[model samples]
Target: MPGKDAHNDTPRRVLDANFPDLALPAAVAARLPALVHCRRLASGRSLFVPGHRPTAFYAVAAGEIEARFTGLDGTVSVIEHVGAPRLFGLAAFAAGQPTEYEAVARGASEVLVIGREAYVLLMDEMPGFARALLAEFARRHDGTLRLLQAARHQSAAERFVLALAQLARERGRAAGDGWLEVTATQAELARLAHLSRQTANELLASAEAAGRVRRGRGHWLWRGDRE
Candidate 1:
């Protein structure tokens, strides 16, 4: 009965010292310790696999998680990265179904797991917390919509420019020499631009050549207005 396997005996994760204080109702926050436990994870650990029955929603209290998708052809897809205080398994917990993606630990991590039933009950009792969670989901949805549009509608150059512009606005620091503090990796920047890694590298080089931007050791600087 692999399909009916149960995870009732799974270990729990609690709030870690490094974890940020989540915006939950006072009552919900008080009861959260009862529902969630703390866990110490090893690097590259698999939290859950796709298609497995999901029993709880996980929050990374002290580290990071990677959301991954596995195709029928065995291709592994890196869907997204989630940092501390972010929630995973919400879809499975919300839909009462298996998780759509696998979650893995990127490094040694402390995580909290709230059982599905407990989460639902807490949400029903704390409408404010539920609203906050819903708002976060909506924000992610909007970002996904924009990513889809960029992938399908925009040229690679347009996507590159747009992504740089958005990052500059969101994470840019003081304008001395116009340096940006964004620390996105090449892979991450490629994902943001909705382009392949090679294409992204080429475009970045092109931007530098045209004096549109300067890639630094740990930051970027807007160098030109070229397109």
Candidate 2:
């Protein structure tokens, strides 16, 4: 659904709600250009690795990046996906800790790299900037924790339904064919729902038979009807 893309910070709807006036001073946006350098990262490239220290936190200019962690058993779990104007390497900026995960460009992406030192400089000079940064980081941390908990607790069927409802509210459009153009594969749906591929397939099969979704080429289109 086109409505699925409805986000506070998505390129379509720009909001001044960014960096709260509570923490980010109005003038701090001016300092961004001086502290940040633009960079183009190609698809499949690794921006940083586990155990590496970051010099700067990146603000997405365009395109998306995937954050993943490799388990000791060699399983790779996609931890998070970030789109434009979102912050990456925020933990490093906050605590000077080595990165715990790997960051890879999901596609050709542009980012503004702002050195931690420069950020610290600005934070010292601008209390608003420091407050905003810390507050944002805390919120993201909480969101990630909640997502992980839901994945761990929710079943394949429940997760699928929850995901569909969210997508319906966010991206679903008013197409007349009793279908919405949700161009996600079963595999991708599995990842998003934090379920295994086979389990995800089973859930979708039941839903399809029950008229909850319809499969199209390289995509899974959700139908609003539920049995």
lDDT of 1 by residue, 52-156 (tens): 887777777677777777779985555556665666677777777887788888788767777865677566875565666777677665754665577679899
Relative to the unseen true structure, what is the C-alpha lDDT of residue 27 in candidate 1, on a scale of 0 to 100?
62
The residue-level lDDT of candidate 2 at 199 comes to 86
Give the C-alpha lDDT of model 1: 0.65
TM-score of 1: 0.67
Report per-prediction Cα RMSD to one decimal: 7.8, 7.1
State each model's CA lDDT, in order: 0.65, 0.67
Query: Which TM-score value belongs to model 2?
Result: 0.67
Evaluated at residue 224, the lDDT of candidate 1 is 36
Q: Model 2: per-residue lDDT, tens digit, 128-212?
A: 6666777877877775675566778966677767555544533355656677766456775677667889988888788888877
TM-scores for every candidate against the unseen true structure: 0.67, 0.67
RMSD of 1: 7.8
Cα deviation of 84 in candidate 1 (Å)? 1.2
